[model samples]
Target: MSDERSLATDRRGAAAHPQLCAGRRARLAEAMARLGGGVAVLPTAPERQRNSDNDHPFRHCSHFHYLTGFDEPQAWLLLEADGRSTLLCREKNLEREIWDGHRVGPAAAPAALGVHEAHPVDALDKIATDKLANAPAVWFPFGVHEGLQARIDGWLATLRERERLGVQPPQAQRDLTPVLAEMRLLKDEHELGTMRRAARISAQAHARAMRFSAAHFRSTQGRGLPEYMIEAELLHEFRRHGAQSPAYGSIVAAGANACVLHYAAGDAELRPGELCLIDAGCELDGYASDITRTFPADGSFSAAQRELYDVVLAAQEAAIAATRPGARKQDAHWAAVRVLAQGMLDSGLLNRDKVGDVESVIDSGAYRAFYMHGTGHWLGRDVHDVGEYLSLDEAPVEQPDGMGGRVVKRPSRVLQPGMVVTIEPGLYVRPAEGVPERFWHIGIRIEDDAVITDNGCELISRDVPVAPREIEALMRG
Candidate 1:
């Protein structure tokens, strides 16, 4: 994609880019002070495998960056409220630097990250044990850090052995995720700015896909294009417009393939009379924006295609209108479901024997045949984002066998200020053995990136057309 210079702000120094990095230090210190005493371990993300002799781009973990803005890998940021944050990183490695990139070496980390002390990464065990001597707790998120977990376990084993001599260890291990997640949920000024740029970059790519696809259709207008070609055009546009990379794989599903919710293979060929559904996003400075649109393959929608498209579009609008701070996210999902089911009933797709009432039919799982996926998901660092739906004291969700587990097909918890999420409601009718021929294959989805605010939520991706007339005009252009 294009370089991030346009969207990039003045990040030359910590003083200049103080909001996400510098400001986070203050908040984290505040949290540490409140907890009495603890040693917080924040590890940088690991290098991801691509293939032999190659690796994917390295991205710093958000939590690590939050406390200490150091982006270097293999670093451990240890925070002690009273003392300084100790940054542990690999020292200068001449051989690896030649293969990879420049190194910020251990010596410079203290000054760069505003830390009081710094050391080589190999010293993690000794330092952690020494700091935790008088601490009642050791804080870190538990699930994703295997190596760190093992290190802590090993250290704890040694301390427990020392207990024979009347030595005490850290009284408890605390989960720091709640504190971090709460802080992230409320986007500061810098985060909102980054999100706006991310949405703009992705919007340009979406518009490019529309303009280019229409042009391709107009010329041999019916020459036909493969689903994968459309997919490539979108990928190119995103990068060309300044996205670091796609937030997720684009779903360029054509005809029946659109019925598959997360379809990413993108191998179908577009027919003259069919629909192409694209669900894609772009990442800017680690922030993400998600957008999905469905349009005619031949530049004009068929009657059935338009019908299903309108139903999905209406559902999206309903969901968008219901979004506001403090409103439970389930409100929008249920509202969209009500509108969608009513449209289906009017289309003769639902009956008394099949679905009882149009208003309540969706929650009964009657809509799965046509709408398999949830209406939306939280969007940020990761596609699903890093946060919990339930409060800190609430019990984790549980399910019996044969039922979709905790993370599957559940409504989002609530809409809160500074939270960014995707609002996408869709409908699909694939031809089936017992179904009528008229409803052969139709799929449509309209997604928007939204930011929740105090007064109301902001629609970050309104640039793309969603209305019937507007979409037609966009295609004509």
Candidate 2:
């Protein structure tokens, strides 16, 4: 949390750097005014080195940068609703810059970030305490940092027993979710453009993986290839295509491994003839793009493979078609689930696939056995970008029906313009060892990033292979 311990060098030549900073400042200003002038503490997440000698690269907090736009660690962004933003950063040191790289310490932070004030990070605690003191309300993410909360408490306690009679804390200490989430709903042009580039790079990575599947594809039959290898290939491609890094962990699940939604370790290999589901995305300039594709390891699906893959792909396509303004985020999921449940019902896998049963599963999400995980996630900034998915009326949007009940349990955030999210509806059938002959090791998932528009949505990764023949062609080409 200190520049003394920071691994970052100074900023290099990049026009995007300043623009990124200014854009976030705009969002912060809007939020600060809404909450009544108060100080908001935005902390930068520090870098965790890969090892003692090899430090990991620092990735700025999307939300924090969305406001302050400072790229240094141990930095704190102070936004005073009075209409001023200041960045507190590490002071520059010749020794460190020569050792690591150039730094945007206190001196350079103002010009670099377009802030009204700049100070050394060392002054953060004192400055924050002074600014937060006596304010009617203090705005800080309590659970996000216990120390900050305790500081607020101490500041309040000091005020209550005030040697200074006029200073006092405000009555309400609310979570800062309302304005922050609301501001992130509509993507500014800059955000949308960055996300578009990320989607484009993500598409290239998927295509590269498809074309070079053999060099790294898994093929052990019952067992699969190491999930990590597929992740490596994608990472290689992402960097080659100018992606700063993966937006999140690359989920490289092979066969039954895919059954575990959000699989962590990428150790499993693609079993020969089995499916390898790659749920991965990369960040281009802090904008995120998520894409998933499941394909056979042998570059061809069996009759059953095609059956299940086609079902998921079909459901995804249908869902994609239904995304539009006025449509809810849940709408697409509802449509995809019904279609997938019907596919399972027709295949005799679910044993029930009628209007009533499908509707029930759509309502209860019983088909999760094969089609687990949400249809998609918000895509931008953080991989699961910010924004409300539900409408003000609280009606569910494109969310698939037949999911578990509980409104909060479901992300009813309405779909709106300038939102980018992935539309990935999948089906995974993992038969217990020697349990059922009807089901066996199989997991198929197809995912794509879609940009929500005013009337409809645009498929950004249309270049990625989704159709069976196209995948085959890409692999064979």
Candidate 3:
């Protein structure tokens, strides 16, 4: 596999655009060194069949790709405590290449991927068994792959059988998810660059959808496009800007359909006075950007729509303002909840008699009637990235039976620079008793990707307009 085409060599003997991948591996190795010495194995995602002969699009496992920049399926990475990295993958085969595509197989993987060693993927079980014997600890995310777990179990059993020969299995088994997740939680400069690009492309896609809705609402022949057409416009913009795919399912909700949180766009017809809510984003270079925008299909908002839309927008603004370094993770959420609760009271969506003041409404859980979902989540390689929110504060204050307890002091994590989070505040009102008829069937959500900075936060999706006037003007144009 050591073809001239495989090596990304330059005049100075440095690989081109290698910082993002190579630097990440170096950092992970450093982190591994900090932990007790051992060998950790990570495998890429496996391909799944879509039908009898076809396969779904392959996506590399986020953790595996973070450690080793190999994107191909059926590949495994090994991290030794001595800062050595090895890759085990399918060997290059010209016959397979003729039918499928090119493969930078094991022969050239070391030079191509900057790994210390490379071997055929078929040898993984044997190699792994040898590496696992007499180890202080074996770090791997358990339950991810049953096959890998079985292999580990086999190695341990074999080592146990070799007790007469003085061979010993690993002393302890540690879960690697927490360690890798903590590393991934903080974005480096390279990850941030990719995320910014993803956000920009996603924002452009939303703008395209808005304009497409306005132009296709009513044609000269009096024919209108369905909700799926607007969804197509979003896909077009995303691909045009080089996005690999949408971060998640594109929600193109029209009319009452907007009230559905994860509405899937279909043949639903777009009406003139109905509000369209699109929650779509693009994934670029493995990073994900999430955004949502709500606007009228006819290029102008109705009075009732504007009233509800403004509330959601204000809530999102309050949430974004509270997303800064040193602020608790729940601070932004609570800020958004307070604003939305107040908006609900003002709009008569929540009755003062039963809901009482905003504080009482929040405490009594009355606000769940309208705002049910969380304001936002951690955003990164995966749409909903992994990172624990709770910090070790104190033990829970339980009842005398020690059941149905409440935490006396539960501390949330403080925001830090390089953390990217979403600020999505929404109001989904269904037809119910005590709800105003004017605001019924109205669902408005305003979301933006915010990157925490030293002073405040930066909204990467700011290019897409969220204000009513700006959305209308963009649609009109």
Candidate 4:
């Protein structure tokens, strides 16, 4: 299908329900009003050429989409504090439409998108300059789009040129990122519904990949199964379930490759006994769902693989337990760390004689060798969604510096209802002198998307079996 047709199909429902975007814009405008009124300019992401006339898939800016719900390129949204919205979009070109499929031309934009006004993209310079004149503040996302600051400067320069004509440029320039980030951090009913669907699709994809790995390994006697093959299965399942795209590049690491975090799906053979770590997700509508599962290739985990998998699973459980309203975000990481540290000590991954006890191991950073990255990150529109991790209003508190010392740092943002996070705890055991050989080259990460609730956290991506026996049972089928 043509790109424009596909985009239209994807957003048909959203276009019909204009209140979602309208409500978000109202909230942002109210925020601007609180800051004493201003004009906000936001541009959608620009399309980039991949190589030699071919272009990468176009994705609208999350912030822009959050406000406008428009997906086309060469578009900009102008929001005024008085609740007026103006959209500058590409003009309808019959010639271009022949190749691109459809354009939500300026004539239909107001009614189609529920914006107050619409104009062709070329009018942004003149319109923005006019809007900025006599404004108390001009708000735009700082340091996001390349050349955005320069463009704003150019607009301000134009306004300054007309200073003698009683044209007054904005006196204050504020970043819109923080405002939008705080807004996007919480998922509304619409966003939550979309995310739940995404999580279900991603869970199914992971399950499909697991079963394919076991079935292929057995059918070919462990000869032809490759990481990309499993990745293909994931992509297939994602699209099969109507997901627009993978949330990020799928990580389909096999055996030792799993030790390297962020390993892209490659041609590594999926050996029978070694574990496969599939860290992947799917993007449905504009929301994202992230999930990771580590499973054995031949259906049953090896003794060592199962041991580490159990530890990572337990750590994820602890993290999930801590993901509730009113709990600080870092509380989940600390909970996961405590479980992982204890598991490492008991499993001999960390020598108890050398690292002392779990607390000592944690304080001394001895657990860094096996478990490196944090337990989780915010999950939403973007995979590593835009939201401040630290609390803005809270005072700094003294916490362990990980070196048997104390340091003052601002606490993480407190989890609240409607917040979405990924509870991913991983252990990558590389061959080291004191590390057990049995645990070497084992990398296990169990992740699930959790939605913070008033009662507790809801694991949205649990359709796939997490237990060893359950996974074995699924693969056996």
Candidate 5:
């Protein structure tokens, strides 16, 4: 691992950077105060059962983890308007600790996580009820956690019972998601550092999978190279480079499987002339890095594959050029669409006689048959990270709906420094009437993580090759 010092320490045992979490909590507290003073409760994700007597791997909630750097299950955080924070976590049971693993019990949570106070998990109802009494509002993420609304209602109900004693329940309930979403839209220095490391690791994994596929194909004369085997290679590289886990399910699509979009790694064999698309990324220190690269099963691409790959690569390049400070978020998507719409006509995927010009193709949405999905999305703690796509402060305006109609909509957000996004453009061709025969069963996507800078966006996931020649040279090595 190059730049090992830049990587965040594994946070499995304890909060790796309590000060950063403390700062985030303070910001939330101030935001709540600005919103008329309230108490906010956020619960971490619960452990889920996979099968009889078996449990799935536990992943902490992104919002909760953002506020408190704690990764334990069955934990909750309370942030008050006065910059006070409380943590409710599992109690220390030596036997359970032996069965599970080390837990930062309530006794140590205050100091370990930089919270003002801590209590056992069982005391949530009592403590929350007390905190909510006479508060103007209670804030929580609506439509997020199941059973959370009922839990807050229970607290309010408890306070209602003592109405005669001058105890008052919260007068209103507010959604905390929008407030936090705005705060998390921009990456701070600490988050940017961690995300950069994750991008590096995921890029290395993609390169490793490429080399593994090419070597296996050459040695066995295009035999015994399954998609799952290549997926395993990616996983191996991610773990070896200190990633906690894959950001999402790995997509190792071979040949026609690539057209399925969300295809999981399966037993599909890597044929010599076919393309294999691997869309995988790693999650390090809670931040995600998503990268996708399509390469030939052998060391070289077929003529049809190379042509389509170049088209998709050119689309991604156009998208990348439009991802910079002051540019609207939709600018990149439209830029890519313009390039792809033209490619579709030039390649005979869409007949110019039928689709007319590129503008007509875009206006009629005729290009969606081959190129669908947006050019990119916000990338951070979650793969498709939480952040509003539309500009909230601006008034809605009527715009052309691409079908010779008008619709009212808010404009997409304007790109700004410290924001992170993914620039992914793809063309998936399935055999159909009027489509080029040579382009059948061919799919190509080029994705990279981009960090918005003062001048332009920086491509963080470019450690792997994107050009046809570079990819061929890399696989040959």
Candidate 6:
């Protein structure tokens, strides 16, 4: 694997980069102000033991991290609509720190994290109850964390009990997710920069995997290459580029394995003539980038492979073109569907006489036999990032019946500036009656991370080759 560390230099230094939690907390507090001023408690993910003695790798909750960049477990953030913030976290214990790891602890959290006050985790109940008393509303993620609802219930009960002492309890309860989700949907400048670096690193990783597959195939004398080897190449490139980890499970599907969307079982052997579809990406500084590329294991695509690859590529291109401000998110998927449906018809994969035109095929969903999934999804802190696809208004979707058909409702979230999404269009062809035998067992998906702009969209992962000739040349070179 190459020692290229393109992303290493781009990473912001830890000391130079404060968590910026102060600004984020202020913004969230402003949003919470509309709720008539209350207390909000957000907790980070709890550490779980992987086994009897060992603990699993700890990751902060996305919502929690969005509010506070604090990464430690056993931590809760208390936000007040009046612009005060408190961090309830673990207290320092030298004995525990020696065996486990260092913690900022309650003592330095206020100064280090830019909060107004800090307390030990044990004081959360008392503090939350006191804060909730006489407040108009209490807000938290309603059903996300297990037992969290019960905890809030207990707090409310405590407040109710104190009502006889002239203390008023919170009158309303609200879920804070919608406000936070909307805030997170539009990427800020810092987030975009981080996501762009993530895309580049992930794109380079894909190229590295392709090169590794090519070399491994040649070295093995056309026998085969294990899927895990290609996956390893992706991992090597990711970590070498300073990524903490892959954004999600690396899908290194070889041959028929590619047909299974979300396939991560990397036990299959990639044959020389087979197409390897690798859907992988990495996370950098809490942002994520997802990219998928399919290429021939032996450095070049076969005739059938090239044909299917072109169709998916064209579909992805149409999806990318449709990704612009003011356009609905579904517009990209429909664009990709139209292109893929036409291509399938032209290639004799779908009979025109039965499936009719692209519109009819789409209405009947006959194309789903080969192309089953959506064109893309929102990509951000999480691979399937949070954001509302639908507005409060309901729009009528005319069904094929022309009279009474199901309303065509999908995530109608309009494309907006700073919104990033994946434009991935794929065809997973399995052997079936009326399906072409040559196209059987062929799964081709072309994916690229796209950021919606005022004029159109920008392809962040454009560094990776998408064209057949370009991929072949890169492998041969």
lDDT of 2 by residue, 254-297 (tens): 77787777886456666567777777888876777888887777
Write the residue-wise lDDT of candidate 5 on 136-224 in tens digits: 89999999999999999889999999999999998999999999998898999888878888998899899999999888988887676
Model 2 sits at a Cα RMSD from the real structure of 6.0
* TM of each candidate vs. truth: 0.88, 0.86, 0.92, 0.96, 0.97, 0.95
Misplaced by over 4 Å in model 6 are: 1-5, 13-19, 393-405, 408-411
Clashing residue pairs in candidate 5, if any? Answer: none
lDDT per residue, candidate 6, 96-122, as tens digits? 999879999988887777788999999
lDDT of 6: 0.86
Best model per TM-score: 5
Model 6 clashes, total count: 1
Residue-level lDDT of model 4, residues 1-477, one tens digit each, is 852234224433355677889989999999999988999999999999999979999998999988888999999999999999999999999999999879998999999999999999999998999889999999999999999999999999999999999989999999999999999999988888788888988998899998888888778876857888899999998886678999999999999999999999988787888899999999988889999999998999888888888888888888888889989998889899999999998899888988899889889888888888888898989999989999899899988765557889998888999999999999998998988899888999999999999999999999898999999999999
Give per-residue lDDT, candidate 3, residue 340.
87
Count: clashes, candidate 5: 0
Instruction: Give the range of the ten consecutive residues with the poorest summed lDDT in model 4.
Output: 3-12
C-alpha lDDT values of all predictions = 0.74, 0.72, 0.82, 0.90, 0.91, 0.86
- Superior candidate under lDDT, 1 versus 6: 6
Please state the error at residue 443 of candidate 4 in Å: 0.2
- Give residue 357's error in model 5 in angstroms: 0.6
RMSD of 1: 3.9
Deviating ranges (above 4 Å) for candidate 1: 1-19, 160-167, 391-414, 433-436
**Regions more than 4 Å wrong, model 3:** 1-19, 218-224, 392-409
lDDT of 2: 0.72
